[model samples]
Every structure is written in structure tokens, then in C-alpha cells.
Target chain A: MGQPLPAPDATDPRRAPDWVRLLEARATAHGARLAYRFLSSRGEVVDTLSFEALAARARAIASVLTAGGAAPGAPVLVVLPSGLDFIAAFFGCLYAGLIAVPVPPPRPHRPDHRMRKVAEDSGARVALTEARLVEQVQAVLPPGADVWTVDALPDAPEAAPRTPGPGAVAFLQYTSGSTSDPKGVAVTHGQLLANQAMLAEAFATGDPTSDGLTSKFRVVGWLPLHHDMGLIGNVLHPLYQGGECTLMAPETFLMRPLRWLEAIDRYRATTSGAPNFAYELCVERIPEAKRAGLDLSSWKVAFNGAEPVRAATLARFAAAFEPHGLPPRAMTPCYGLAEATLLVCAAEAVEVDPAGRVCCGRPPAGATVVVVDPETRRPRPDGEEGELWVHGPAVASGYHRAPDASAHTFGARLSDPDDARVFLRTGDLGYLDRGRVFVTGRLKDLMILGGQNYYPQDVEALTTQAHPGLTSGGAAAFAVDDPAGERAVVVAELHRRNTEDAAAARDAVISAVLEGLGLSLSEVVLIRQGTLPRTTSGKVRRSACREALLRGDLARLDGMTS
Target chain B: MTTPDGTPPEAHRRSSRASSAELRAIVKSRAQVEKFLRLGLAEALGISPDAVDPTRTFTTFGLDSIKAFALTGDLAEWLDRDLPATLFWDHPNIEALTGYVADVLGLAE
Candidate 1:
């Protein structure tokens, strides 16, 4: 198809490409075309930016950073709300040849230690944010890192643009890691563009020669700009295709699920996506009256990812919105992680395996997926479950500043004699069946709820700190799938077992988790001391504890409710 | 019925705080606000209204951030007022939230 799309090779001078160059060319080619539209909570267009305006603003912000003595390859933190300023600041960092780090703004009245930890880990000396969040971001950022309000910067049309090499770091994605140790995945320009190309090939959004197809590639979404799915999949993918993207705040969509569908209808968006929970929310919360007005026929790709894809959720969503012009083939279940730069595999339609796991489709062109035995580092045959290992140019080189962790995760060599490629250990367990990927479960002890990653150790530490009677290393936190969604359940061993003390301990654990982690526990089980299962080395076996809890094998403390 | 934590049930707490006639006379708006929050919280938790104790904190019923925000959004829609995003966090219990909401609506007794 039209020269078979060249592989993304940053070293090739003939095709040396980066997002900055791509955007600059697009600005010159069609400066007046719509780039992004920011929508208000009520679905009103509050802000609009064309390619020309976006390029100008990015240059203005870049000049400010460059004039302020920002060196090339330095990491700059972008802590702004979901709006035009966030997008401009991100491009501004790239324009200045600095690595952009996008993170969520701190919540009001809450001490954002996570943001502070990220700043400390990345060693970001300059932070860009909106005017209203200048003070908030300044309070959380490490001392000496200047916080500049992007809106206040003056436009500098003659600013000298800095062009970074393809191998240079483009951005630092800090989606993984715990609060105490935040790891920033260093994604190079080559890897970023390569992943974007893979996505285009998989979604068939390439080929700019087709004017009709290019115009029909409009994307509408409300995912947060900081997350990988939103940044890479929703934001960058549209730019790669030279298509328009309309965005609204995640809170706006969550407040009223109907607004998302209405936006799709209003914009006639060809692509949109959210996690499985969002689809479930639409089915549960949106009344019938709201559905009558939605016309989702324009939505060609409704991707569900960032968490486990439930067949039931997809079926329910399809059945509910079928009458409103939604085609059953529009649902796409995808699998990806920050380390992979965005997407790894995605299916065009919902195809559930006999085990009830939804298919995530085949690996895109130039990418390879192999299941491997986590213990032996040996590759598993097809239809066998094991840790998934990905090999391709789309996989990131490694985590920034952590060579040992990077080598362990990104330097795996397959045992097969014929295949000597380095594979990324995806910590996710799945199997390949008939050229399709069906994810079974996670091998790591991480819990994903509401599209947010929560480490078991973080939750356990918070739970133990909530009450003195609870043992420090005696708590096991894990996720259990329910019809509502994936929910966390904490089983803790308490020293004191009196009725009042047990009740107080349970309440304290719940409150601490909600306040500290912003998560709700489906159940707080107070077990007797020495009842929690542990390994020979005394580490808590979380999966065993989960199974025991599911089987009602854990001995409940006296006076504790089920 | 007294909860396991020895706290009185929702009905008992309501009656002890103010008689129905006195509450109606003092402020009819307070009851309306409380009923709205109670019903919204019940629906969010997938529990019956009778099982919801207003005196108990929102966290006691395991209200996560997403559910809290969703409930607050529904309350904002029902009241037709632009409530703060931290409405639930600032006033964690139903009684405190009702009081704050009533005060914000200028229905203080």
C-alpha cells in the first residue's frame, strides 16, 4: 500500500523525523486547520487552537525556556490542567530540546507527595503550569525549581528553535513506580515516532494521500493528557495523521458520561476510547433519555484499554448503545504500557477466548509478542500462559537513570537459538492463541483500579500506618474483579481483637487508604495475628492471600464482620 | 438498631438532633438537602436508603474518590449550583455535608 510505509529509522538522514519537525511541516502546509479544541464540562467549546497558533505559542514558550538558560536534554516538568496550556507547554519543552515530563496537578488541600517524589526523581529544575496553578505547583515542586506560568509568557516569533537528534530523549513518562521510588521512562524521539507509526499501521490511519480518509480521522476524547493513553494514543496519534482532536477534561466526562457520547456525535469523531470502567459507567449511570439523542455511528474506533478488558463490559456497552447508531465492530480492546511508548496490540472487534478473556489482536507491524516462563526465562508455545515479552523498535530503551532495573526489564534474551532479540519483560501474563493475544492476568503484584496503577506495597504501608494494632508487614492488598469493576481488598492481621478495637481498626484502615491513596477498599478483613500467609523468607504472598480470601480460608478475628 | 461500632442508627440520630416539627419550622431546606445527599450516597454505594447512616462518615462506607466525585457531581446537578470539587472531602459525613450545603445555599437556621 503506497510504498509499504518506511520503518521509523531516526538514523536515516533522508527520513530523519521527530514530532517537532513533523508539527513544523504541518504548520507550514496547513496553518489554518484546526489542531485541538478544548471543551467545557457542559460540552461548550471554551478554547480552540489551530496549527499556526499552536506552533507560535510553542515557539514563545520555548524562547522563554531557552533565554532562561535551559540546557538541551534537561527534563522540564509540565504540571498544568487538561487544556491548551498543557499541550503548548509539552511542545514547548520539545521545541527547546528539553525532555518534557507531564504529571497531574496537585489536588486541592492535599499534600501531593507523589508529585514531589516525581520532581525529585527526574531532577527537573524548571516547571511550567497555568496561572491559577502557579502557586500550587510551586508549593509542591522541589525548592530551587522555578515555576513559570505559561500563559504569562510573551510571544517571541523570532525565537531560535533547537532541534534535538532522533536518539535524544523527548520526554520522561513517570507512570510506573511507587511514591518512594518513582521511575521515569526515558522515551527517545525515534521510539516515540516508531510507536506512533505502529499505531497508525494497526489502526490504518496512515496514508495522507487519501484526502477523504485523512479528513475522517477526527479523534474526540476526555482522557487526561498526562497518561500515556491520552498523550500518545489520543494526542500524538492525531498529530501524526495530521487530523483534528477534540479534548475535554477527564472530570467533565466522569461527572456526566452522556457528555462523552454527545461530544462524539457532535464532532462526528472517527476514534475515541476509555478504560473498561468508563464503558461500564455509561451503561449503569446514563439514563435512557440521554441515549436517545446520541449518534455514535461516527465513532469508528472505540478502544478500551489501560486496564483489564472485560467481555461483559464490552457486551453490555454494545447492547446499550446499539440503538444509538453504535456499530458492534467499533469496540477495540488494546494492551499497552508506558514502557512500550503506548500501544502494543489491539483488536478491531470484540473476540473473547474460551477462557472469557478478550483478544487484544496481533502485534503491530515490526513488533513481536512472545509469552515466556517468568521463572526460567524460556519462551512458551502458543496457547500457553506466561509473562508476555515484547520485542521491537516500539519498546523503549530503558528507564531513565536506572540502568540495573532497565537491563533487567528491557535486556531479556530469549532462550531460543534462532531468535536473539532483546525483549521487554511486560510483567503481564497472557497467551497467544491463533495469532491473537488474550491477556489472562498480571504476574506482578500491582493493582489497577479506575485506570490508575496502585502498588501493593504502597497500599500496605498506608494500611499499617493507619492503626497501631495492625502489623506493619502483615497486610496484603490485591484487586478482585467484580461486576462493578476491579476493586481493592485489604486483609490485615491485627494484634488486638476486641469488637470495638476491630471496628475502629477497620474504619481507620479505610479512611487512611481513601485519604492517602484516594482508593476505596471493598472489604477490610481483620484477621488474627500469625494467620496471614507468608513465604519462607517472610514476605507476604499476595496472590495466595487473594485466593484464601476468595475461598473464605482466612480466619476472621472475633467480632470482625465478613 | 445500634451499629457494631455502638453508634445509633440514622433515624435515631436524626430524631435526637431535632424533632420533625422543629426541623420543619427551623429550616425546611435542611431536610431537603439532607434527603438528597442521603439518597445520592445510598445509590452510589448500591445500598438501601434505610441502611445508610448519615452520622457515619463517607469513608466508613468505603466511598472511593471516583464514587465520591460522581456523587458530588450528581448533587451539584440536583442543586443546580456550582459546588467545589472538594465538597465531599471537606465535609466527609452526611450531616456535615448537609449543613455545609445548606449554609452555602443561604438556608442556615
Candidate 2:
């Protein structure tokens, strides 16, 4: 049922070059059609917005923003919770030709360092949030930056949407970098549309003419709207296809994953997805008795991405939900990142490699994926593991305000003379088997747990600061497979080999991580002095340390063994 | 605080800031609440109910942030009321959490 997108026409303005124009066209054609439905945690629809109403709200917010001295192309932070207000504010930024920076709202009674880091890095002078959270958002924003409540904006007369050039930065997607330094990927309007179109083709979403089944291409998702997968894949994908999207807060799903399936069944969602942990959570938490009276037969595409796709997770999920009318073929394991503006490759069918890694399928049209040896910068043959280098329209322009990092990551050149194209060095190690991509491991030491990225250096820094026994710069943080999912393991060398000190240090490390980063360590191994693996330059080799920890080669302190 | 159909009780349906007296009247007995907490913690940590010692902190059983949040969510669902997101952090051990819950529901005798 999937088909390739039509060629771009530079002359035809009605074809919707950017998201602003796309929404304008949809407003004109499907003015009364339901665009979004925001649901409460109790499975009740709290708010609904039609295309026309959404356009009107966006225009009003845009007018207010412009009147408040927001210059076009300036970054505006959209720091609201998961609701229709967040969606309207995001579009309002585009309607005003401003770059939208979507960040998670600050938690209650917590010091929001991440929000402050994002606000500082994006250089956003204005933030848009709900009435209830205006004060909280304002507290974390830079001193001069102002916060406005989106819900209280007065209605304004409709104005024509601004059509910025396709190359103009539409939004800044801040990847989960370190707490001190967050990286915001500058995604242009052209790149966003290209990735959405590719998703439409790959998932076969919004195919109204395919059959009666394609008539209602709805999507139900509970992923956090601040993240790339939730914003691009769940929220925007439905609008791109002129279909309705039903959204709930991420906490709603995590609280009871059964609500996700119940909503999908109730809404007859044709396309929906989350990270692999969500599916595993459902299979683990949802009892068999709760599966009664649910009908997922109408569900078509269940895309899994944003983290490693485990063969065991997919198989277990399918086995658990198959009785509820979920087709085994609907389990789509895809791969993507924030730098790529969302999707890179997606498999149509569930396939596994000999190494138990799920096949991420081939790159979509208009995207070229090549596996290359990172050290030699030469292309690797099929079935050989190498870094995945991508060159495509979907790739973002670069990191905002980071020239060196942008050049190092986005301006990669292969050593092969035949291929002169510049590629985005995806720091992800994988191998291509006859054109299909299979991710083996991460070339970068980034740990992804619960669809959130955690840099090891950040974890190690927090671990070392927790106690005096933990030697400074002697901690190595890494992820290991657990029954629940990937869990963080902190291996630190103690300053002294005292058993009492080791126990105290372990407890201190766990509490510090939880209090500082709001994360829990699965295990904390305190090794003797100089037992950790380090390079000649004294840089900790996380992979080597992880191997040593797993193999029990490290001389762990007494009572610190797993 | 669940009805026969497992829906939240009337007191919990009002708001998150319900009066303690109203909650006390509608909530289950303290022993039943403790049993539920132990069972829920065991289910979340994937261990037997007996293994869930009331004296030990949740961190001792390797309950990470996500699992702790999920356990809180389940407890909220069972009691049919919204609890603080930092419920686990504020009440580190089962004994402390049970005491907090009892005080909130006015179960102190």
C-alpha cells in the first residue's frame, strides 16, 4: 500500500514547501476535519482541535508573539506539557517564521538543570508555556528571557502564514546531551518535510485510496512531545498525512501501558510507535485478564525506534498482543536519531540478523546510507561492521552554535575516490547486509534508557562527586542488559580498599545519581586502585571496563561483587 | 479506595487535594493498604511478596527511577488519587511510605 512521494516542484507554492505552508493548505482543504485529540489520563478526551481552529490558534499566538517583539528567525522555547497547547505553540512559532525549541517542562519541586541548559544553549529569549507552568518555566529561563502562557492569548484575525525559505531553520531539537552542555540540532524546514514524506511512504500512512482500511489513518501515542520521535514521528506525521492524532502524556502510558492499547483500539489507530522499552513494559505489566474485549485488528503500523531494537522484545511483544488481533507483520523496527531529523531506515517486516539484532531495513528514497570504517574512513563490504554514514535531505543542517562539532559530525568524507559525497557520521556501529541495515552497537558511549540519552561522562562525573572514596576521573559508566531493559552500571575505582568505605561509597553513588540526575543505577562496582582500564593518555576505556566488569576480571572490592 | 468495578472512589474522584477525613472514610483499611503496597512493590521488582522487606529501602532492591515511578503510578491507580511524582524519593523505605500513606489517608490510630 506504500508509494513513493511525488517529485518536488519549486514553482508550485500550493505543494507546501515548509510545514507552515503545509498546515495552511490543510486548513484550506480540510478546515473542519479533526486534527488532534488530547486525552486525559482516564481515557477521556479533554480537548479536540480541528484544522481550522488549530490554524486560528496558531495565528493568534503568532500575532501575539510578534507583537511582543519576537523577531522572525529568533529561537522561541515551547516548554509546555503534552497537550493541544504545545502543538499550537509549536505551529505558532512556524507561523511567525521563528525557530521553535521544544523542551520538557520542569518537574514539580525539582531544580531543572536540563531546562536551564537547553534554554542557555538555544539562546531563546521567549518561552511559551501553559498558565499553570509559566512561573516554573520562567524560573529556569535566562534572566532576560520572558515566559508567556499560551492558553491566555486572545484570539486574533487570521493572517497569511509566513513562507520562510526551505533552508531556514524550523526548530531546534535538543538531543539529551550532558547536563551542563546540551546540543540542539538545527533542522531546516526542508529537512523536516523530507523526513515526514519518507515516513508517509514507508509506513503507508494516510492512503485514503488504498482500501477501506486506509480511510481513517489515525495515530495514538503517549511519547513525550519534547523528544524527536514523539514530535516528528507521532505528532507531525499525522498532520502531514491529513489524519487525526490522539495524544496523551508520557506519564499516562508509563503509569498504565494498558491505556495505550486501549486508546489504540478505541481510536482505531493505523499508525503508532514508541521506543522498544514501551512495548516490553506493556508485555511485562499488562496481565492476561486485562486483554479481554480489546480489538487491535484495525491497527496497521507499530513502529519501534529511538533505541536499540531487540529481537527478544519484538518477539515477546508480538506473542503477547497477537491474541488481541495485532498482526505480527505490523511490528516495524526502525532506526533514527535527532541529527537525521527523525527517521533514517525502517523495515517493513520483522527480520533478525544472525547476531539477534533486528534489521532496520534500507534507507528511504532520497537518503543514502553507507557503512564505513571509522579509523580508515573507507567503505566496508556487506556484513562487516562499521560506522553508518548517511547523506540525505532528511539530515539536519548542523548543531546550533557548535561549529567544530557540526563539522566533525555532519561533514564526514569517505576515503573512497568514487564517492565524493559528504555524509553525516552517525557514530552508530552497524553493518549492511545486501542493503539492509543492522545496528550492532554504539560507536559512541551514549546509554539510551527509557528513550532518553545519558552520556557516560555525565554519569561518571556525578558518580565521582558523590563520595571521597570514589577516585576522581576513575569512574566508567555503561549500560548492560537487564530483565527490565538496559540499566546503567557504574564501575568506579575506590581511593582505598576499605570494605566499609566501599559500601558507603556505593550507597552514596546511588543516592547522588537519583537526586542529581533522577536516574537509578542497576549496579555499582567499586574496584581497587588502578584496576580500571585506561588508555595510555589516562582516558578511561568504557568498553574495556565494561568487558572487564562483565568477565569478572576487575579486582572489585570486598562485598562489591554482583 | 476502588469501587466494585475497580474505579476510583468518590473521595478520590473529587481532586488531588481531597480532605483527609473524606479520604479516611473512603480508603481501605491500613493493613489492606500495606498488603497492597507490598504486593505492588514485589510485582514491580519481579520478586516474591515475602522478599519485599518493609524495612529495606527501595534502592536496596535495585528499584531504579523508572520502576519506582511505575510503582508509584500503580499505587496511585489503586488508591484512585493523584500522588506526588517524588513519592518514592520522599519516602525511601516501605515503612516510611506506608506511614506517609496512612497519614495522608488519616489512617493513624
Candidate 3:
């Protein structure tokens, strides 16, 4: 509500550049601004915390973590849901100079594979979780590590040290690892500052403050904080812009899709984001009664990314909520990845062309997105489809402990061989049509049958459309190459009663997938909905599902084979 | 709704009409139903029974149709409940769905 003093110059040694400083800055300026709200089902704020309060708690947490024998730079795996405590733990780690590795919170229905993968990959010396996960984390803790809840940590010290500097490593974000082994992308404070500054510059151009400070913008999000999009896009961006944010647990968003919209209305959130599926969920699930009295005029930036951006999903959401004052341009379908510190190209909140569409507008000032041939490493023509390569300050310092992987994914040249530009090879396959990124699909998820490439999403989409019983957005179509040659198999979850016969369900699923995808599915395993493994962010864990199917350990769909 | 040690008056009356095993099945299915409705039926109804009656109305469990749709669509999948999409309104509650399952396939004890 008031103009704040300017932040000290970049060279000032007192201010550190990591996320720790982000919280500290907020505490210094507008410390009383509401940073979080734990909402009830009715969208009432059940609990609220100010930025200064959160920062102080984080400083306290940093003292406890350091006192608990946590070595600086040691990987501290965080397995917690989105909330005030989650944010505190994340920033506390940054303050203490520890590497934060966020894993999805465990689900009751999922097999132990996710925990196993995280434990193996991170080699975490400590696991910070909630009371609900105490026993589970204890049971799943790797050979050597301590597990503690938020309450278990010691009180904040009255005098905690200042935030870490810009050169400090902030996090080790593990890629989805669908193609190869999961590699941790090391993000530095300087890299984060650069990316967030670019993002703020792009979105905050109309912002009234010439000092690059903002007080009007606010973020409301339900995306999993563990994700790059959630951590940087929704959380850090708001803090960097000197604005506040409201966050809810991912389950809250998934369980009640309309609650997301209600939060925007209640909080008057100016900016928010989610992937394509989230918009699809809102479109399919928001009830007519719940839609009453809803106004989305204040929601300025609604980003769709983390997965391929779908034009139809955006169109449906816009059409359904137009009466509620939901703007078409506010539904921005963007593109980016973990390598780029979460964002690459985002559409400005503006009206789309005549064609019912959502465009991932253009790369921000310090960024460039080029479609390149995966084989030749040459930039393709303007409108051609190829691997999307990104160059920017957001391009993170490569994989932790894996120099070879870092080299392969982060640097490749065009022409002259020796003159190379540091570019992140975003394993995403897409075409540049009119300089806008139209994501086709993931290169790793592509199935090659008879030498023709087929995207799994195409088959999965058709399966959901054909069979009402088949779970939407919960199917996996993957290629299995054996002595019998390569064949595509679609594993779909079916909604049915336990008393229902299995043979009938399997037959129905196979027929539906076959007819929909126009290819005979090598196998159709009718798993119970939610039985399929999923990331903490509610994304269908395709890699885990494929591994389960391959190992004959897909529990609910076991015993019967189609 | 009552404490874990005591049954609610409505639940007590409903349980008298069904056997314990049948009630257990209903309770098991209600877990699925909670996923179906997405709301925590246990918390909403304020009932912590290890089992529930299969023929009672979902309204008795303190849920309305609007919240029921959210649960059925999203929560059901997250909770691993595999009920038909239309079942949210049809079954409505643990007891009603249990009764429906029994009538369809004689699953009642």
C-alpha cells in the first residue's frame, strides 16, 4: 500500500541472492502482507501467515537444521504437502546453505516404487515430512538418514545469519527421468534471480512502480510446490515482485477442482498457473451451482505448462467461464522446463486470433527458443517441428554430480561447430509456428511402430473419449520391444465395482483402446482408477506405471492379462 | 456422528438392518465413495466407524450433491475408487451404494 525503500544494489554484500533473500526482502518490505492462506472447502481462509512471520519461522528452522548435524550442501529430501510449513522448510534449507530436494508426498494407494526411486537418486541425509508420513518415512528412509516433521524441529534462533549469496546452489531439481536415469538440475541463486527478473520484467511492464517494485499482483496456486513450475513460477515469482501468494495443497485442488477458481475469486488473485490437465479438470468438474457468483476479472495471468499445452482445454475453460468474466487472454498456454528454472515462453494476457486458440506468446527478453533437429543439431526453418532448444539465463547449471549428462543436455552448437551457445535441450518435441511454441509431445513418450512415430497422448486421449468407464488422463500408451518386435500397449484404469467381473472390463478396455487409437493394443490391463502411479503433482507417473507393468507388479490389474 | 467408541443414532439404526460383514463391505466401499465424492466423508459426517451401513442416504453423512460431484469426479480417482461416473448421484452414500451393490450382485452378507 506504500512505496518501499529501494533494494540495495546487486554488488551489496549484505543481501544474498538465493530464495532465503527473497523471504528476507519480503520481511523487510511489506512484512505484514499475507503470504499464505489455508482455505476451507467454502474458500474461507482458515489460516493466514505474513511474509515476515514466514521468514522468521524459516530462520528458526534453519538454526534447527544446522544444529541437527545437517552438513552444509548435504541433500535434505523434503516430502511434504504444499502449505506454510512446506514453504518454510524449503527456504530454511536455502538459508542454511543445504541442497533442497523435494519429492512428492507419498499416497496410500501407490506402491513403494516412488520412495525407492527418490531414496536411491537423492542419497538424502535427512527427510523432512509431516506427522502423517512419520511411520512411512521411517520405514522408507534409506540406509542412513533422519526423518522429522515440522514440529519436531527446534525453535528459531533469536539471531540467525543473513541469506546465502547469489553464487550458492539453491536446489537439485530432478528431471522426470522418462528417457534415461533421473538427473538433478542444479539451480544457483544468480540463475534464479536472472530468470525471475526476466519474468518480472515481462509481466510487470504495466506495473505502476518504476523501481521495478509491485504491490498489486498476487498469486494463488494449487500446483505441487515440489515442481519447478510451482516452486519458481507461482511461488518465487510473486516474492521477487514484492507481492504475496496464497497456496493450497495439491490434493485440495485435485479433490475439489472448483475450489481453485473460488480461491481466485475470494483472494482476487492476479496471477496463477497449471498444466493442461488441470484446466481440463476444472472444465469437466466445476459444477453449475459452484459456478454462481464467480468473477475471474482480477485473474490476470493464468499459465498452462509443465505438460503439452492443449488448445481445446483452454477453449473449453474460456467458453465455460466467459459468463463469469473469465478473459480469453488470461488463459495463457505457455512452455518451459526444469532446465530453464521453470519458464521459457509465456503468452501475455491478450485476446487470441479468430481461430479458437491459446498461444505461448513469445520468449521473454533474455530468452530465445529455437527448434532444432535432434540428430543434426541444426536449427530448423521457422515453421518446422523439431526438438525445442532454449537459451537464456534461466538455463540452469547442469546436473549435479553428472558432468557428462550436463554437457549433453546443456550445450550444443549450430553450424561453425566451435562457436557454441549454451542451450538446454528441452526433450520436448514441438514446432515453431509464427514464433510461438506449439508443443506436440514428449520425445521420450513417442512410440515407434513400423517406423512411424505415434505420440502416446493421442492414443490415451482417444481411449478416454471412446470408453466412459476408462479413466480420463490416467492411461499410458507405451512401446514394448521384444523378440516379437515392437508393439504398443495401452494401460488404462477402468471405473468399476469390485463385484464387477474382471474379464468383461478387460475386454471393454481393449476394444475401446483398439477402436479409438486405430491400432490393436498389444495388451489392455484394466487397472482400478488411482491405482496407476502418479507424481506428487497429480501427473500420471508413466515411467513408474511402465516399470510396474513390465515387472508384472501392477497390483490391482494383476492375475488377468489381455 | 459420534466418537470412535460410539455409533451415531442414525448409524445405529442403519446397522440394525444389516449384518456386520455387510456393514464392513459398505465401509470398505465407502472409502471408495469418499474418493468418488472427493470430500472426506469421515470428517464431514463426523463418524469414525470402522464400518458403515449400506442402505442409508448419503445426506445422512452430511454431504450435498454439489460436493458429491467434486468427490466423485476427482477425489474418487485420487482415492483409487473405481465407481461409475454417474454413481456419485446414484449411490449417494456408503449405505446406499452398498445396498445398490447387493441388489446388483447379491454382495450383502
Candidate 4:
């Protein structure tokens, strides 16, 4: 920790002028102060970048990106591991006025075609990535894909940062890998700044300009840099505060959850969190002996988001770490989506709802949240179930290149013309109670399993074609929550009077699903053909299939209990 | 508890929930430890036991932190001894994990 940088003005959104100028100001003010501390897997500090050093590196990369004929509004792909290199490339995109499209490098030795889909969907010609991944990514790229390692880019004259207008597109936050139709949420410069400020306020991180740590603003977490929570919360917000962040690879945290807490103690980090499963991981993984040396007293706001927050998880985590000094209220069960640029609402307190509704706090400054009746298109009174709609500065205007989809999702208006403002339909089923948003379940059939979104149709498509016994369109994949975690339960109907051996077919189906979509189906129920419920349009009724499985109504052909 | 060859005597390895006779009857050699892990992980991950790659990392099977913790508890129970949650991370693959678990229990080298 060198001489701390003078705090930037984080109060005003009008002055945000996008994130570029803020970085420039912070770089000058906090020239020697640490901006990012990247930790190695062996509990070692591999790289630490100062604010000034980070800016210089970013500017150098920006110069290269601009010199290579990338347009101001074009999307530049950020395909690097979670490290300082990715941070520089991202800031370089913002510096060069390019929308940085961050995505996980194709799963090693596997064709995770999502990379190509995102690249083509974003129309990104050039990709800023590590040298090691250049060959791997190049093999998947269409002809003439400009793949340049950020380190290889020669240090050139620092390009004048291209600052875009407030409404100008900053980055395309790809919501999911919907393969055929990927969603790139068009987050503008204004929304980015607004969301950062809003998140800071919600997380109770006192000042916008002061990096959260000095005033207890430090965020220590191992969330993937490509994710919304990682990008907006961990990376960008710290930059906005002119503060430093201690970041580790997601694998480091996954491989050892204790390292995440160790960093919190090591850095005296005040803010750090992950999905609910992470808290559970720490609770279940960290034995009593390993917990002896840990001191989580420095952890002030351990806000859990990105997945369903279980009250039991919060209680277990608090009870387990109370001796080590993790406060009860520190485990805040908040909620947000990429559509809202990250923090839509954060609860005021840790009040567990008996109905299993995790309180996703009141809307942040200038943000309005309402639960609208799905069919009526009318606002429902608080304490009633309905589709949640959010209207705010942080809410992105629309999905990139998908006008109809954008109009339906973003331009949501109640039947009452008096409330004319457009709201982004969250598609989450929840009710606002006493000004706090309580998310109950998803309105749509989107299943979030193991922290990743898996639409039933995509899974159904994979499972249905798994075996000859399975009808081409007679399979349904749904999520079933058990003690272990949310798992995919596949209920497929086999062809009637088929001579195929049920055991072999079942194994083939399971293997096919794993190969086709890389998803491990927890239970595969082989029912008699035509046993699966279907809608009038001949589409498989996933909910009915799930209900039938749960209620034990489906007839099993193999006489094996699934 | 050491046998003549230095490995822990198979009969001495104890499990709390179950009687030693049944548990002892199951695992006699080093290969059994690998088989035990393969079956445990395969069932936990919902794949056929044969499909569970001994060389592939646990995360390759889409094992998240939640499932890892659950699997750890199961592993601890089967071993009849308490184990740290980092066992998965330390061992990574089934083949390596089985060797580490066996070494910890002093079952075989």
C-alpha cells in the first residue's frame, strides 16, 4: 500500500464521463498506490499493478487496438484468464472506445462453441487474449480473426482516450450462451457509471471515489472476471473508487475456498462475496482446524448474489465463522442480473423470509422496482406474486441486435398509461414487501443450476437425441432442488414396443447429454413412449414432466427407480 | 497398525457408522481405494461408474463448490476417518485422490 491516491468524485453521474476519465484522474492522483493485487495459487502475490502503472499498460494496449484499425464503437473480445492482463485489456477497450466482450476461453480440448457464437454475435474482429490461448482461440475463429496478445502489442504512443457520450455503448454484457440466440445486454456508458454508484450505495461502501478498503471498501473475491458480478462489482467499482482490489483466479477459490477468506484477512478486505453456494462451500469445506488461523473480522459486507440465496446457508455460514468474526448481517442475500448492470436491489438487513423469499433490498438511488401481473400487465400490490419489472438508470435500454427481444424485455409498460416509463422485465417471480424485493422463483422456465443458466429447451434438445429409444421431441429437462444442490432431472419417453434394451438406452442417453451439452443429468427417467406431457403446439411440457417425476406419476419401462 | 510391509494393517482401519467387519471386507488393496472413489464420484456426479475418468479433474465433471463439499462428507464417512475439505483440490483426479486417501489411512503405499 503506497501513498494513497486522492479520492475521485464518485457522487455525480453527469461527471462520470464514462470510466476512462476516472481512471486517468485516479492514475494521476494515486500514482504509486496499488490498484490490483493478483495472487498465485500457492498463496503468493504474483503481480501487483499500481493505478498509474495500470493506466499506462491499458493506454499502451488501447494504442495497439486503435492502431490496428478497430473502430470506436466496435466490440473487442477479452479472452484471457482472470488476471491483470484481462483487466488491462478491458480498460483498453474502454480507453479505445471499444465495447469489451469478455468470455471464458473455449473449455480446453473441448468445443465449447459459445466462444465462436459470442465472437460472431458481437461481431468482434479482434480479440485481446493471452499468448498461450492464441492458437486455441484462432482454430475456432472464422478467417481473418485478429488475435493479438496484449503483452505482444509493442509499446506505442499512448492514444488519446476516446470518451463516448453518456448514451454511447460501453460494453456488450452477454447475458447467456443461448447458442442460436445469445443475449448481449447493451450497457451504455451512463448505465455503467450509474450502476457502479448504485452498487456502492447498496453495498454500504461509503464513498464512490475512495476505493472501498481505505474506508473499508476493499473487495476480495475470486468471481470470474468475465461474469457480471466480477466485472461490475469486483473490477469496475474498485476502479471507480480509485481503490485497490485483491483478485484471485476462480479456480484458486474453487480449489480452496479458504484462500478467499485468507485474502479477506490478509488484505483486511471489507467487501467480498460470491453466489450462495460459495458461502456453503466455505461452511462445508473449511474444517475447524483450518479455521483456527483465519480472522474474517475485516469482512464487513459479504453480499451474496448471482444465485438463489438460501437462509440456511446464511445461518450456517454465520454460525460456522462467528468465532472467527464474520458478523451475522455480513451475509447479505442480495439479488441482481446483467440486465440491470449488476445490483438492482440490496436488502437493508439479513431477515430470513419463512416463505423462502430472499429479500433483495429496496431499489438503489433513482431505480424503481415494481411487481407486475404477468397476464394483466398491471402493477400488483406489495406482498403478491408477480413478474418483477425494474425501471432505472442502471437498467440497460435493450439487448444488442435483437430489437424484438429488446422491445419485449426492455420496453415493458403497464396497461395504465399514467405510468408511461418503460421498465425492463426481469422475468423473475417475486413480490415487493415493505419496500424490499423478495424473489421467490423464476417466471420463465430458465433453470439456474450450479451458477449457470440452462434453458430447458437447450437441455431437452441434447437429451432427446441421446438414444434411439427416445422420441426426437419427447424429452424434458428440468431442475430439481435436493439437499446436495439444484440438479438437472431428465424425464424422457422411450418409443413404445421398441426392442432397444432400456439399461443400455438409459446409459446412452446419459452419455449423449454429457457429450452434447456437457451437463451431467442427475436422474434419467425412461418412461413409456408418449408418456411425456406435451402442449397443444407439440412442445414438451417441462414443468409437467418435472411434476410427474416428483409425484412419482410417470410409468417406468425398465422397472428401475430413477 | 503397521503391517510387515509398512502399510497400515487392513483390519485396523475403522469406520464409525458401520462395523469394521463389513467395511474391512470391502476394501483390501490399493486398487479398491481407486474403485471406491470412482464409484462414489460417479454416483454423486450422476454418470456411469465406467465413464468417470480417473485422470480428468473433478471440475471437469461439472463439480461445483456445493457438490464438492457434499462429496467430501461422503468421502469422510466411507474412509471412517475425518478428512479436510481440500482433499478434492489436493488430489484433483480420482486416481490421484484414491492414492492420497489410501496414504492418509495408511492402507497401502
Task: List, in order, the clash count of every candidate structure.
Answer: 0, 0, 12, 7
> Which of the two candidates, 1 or 3, achieves a greater DockQ against the reference?
1
Q: Interface RMSD for each candidate model? A: 4.9, 4.6, 15.0, 7.1
TM-score of chain A of 3: 0.76
Better by DockQ, candidate 3 or 2: 2
Residue-level lDDT for A24 in candidate 1:
83
Candidate 2 residue lDDT tens string, A121-159: 988889898888888778767787767789887555555
- Across residues A19-75, which tens digit of lDDT does each residue of candidate 1 receive? 778778767766889989999887899999898888888888998888778789999
Error of 4 at A460 (Å): 0.8
lDDT score of residue B59 within candidate 3: 42
Q: Which candidate is the best by lDDT?
A: 2
Point out where model 3 deviates above 4 Å.
Answer: A1-16, A155-159, A178-180, A209-212, A349-358, A446-476, A479-562, B1-109
Q: What share of the true interface contacts does each candidate keep?
A: 0.57, 0.35, 0.11, 0.02
Tell me which of candidates 1 and 2 scores higher on lDDT. Answer: 2
- Residue A80, candidate 4: Cα error in Å is 0.6
Clash pairs, model 2 backbone: none
Residue A53 shift from truth in candidate 1, angstroms: 0.7
Q: DockQ for every model, please.
A: 0.30, 0.28, 0.09, 0.10
lDDT of 4 by residue, A354-432 (tens): 8755677888778989999978999899889999999989998788788999999999999998877999998899998
Off by over 4 Å in 4: A1-14, A155-157, A207-215, A483-485, A497-500, A515-518, A560-562, B1-109
The local distance difference test score of model 3 is: 0.66
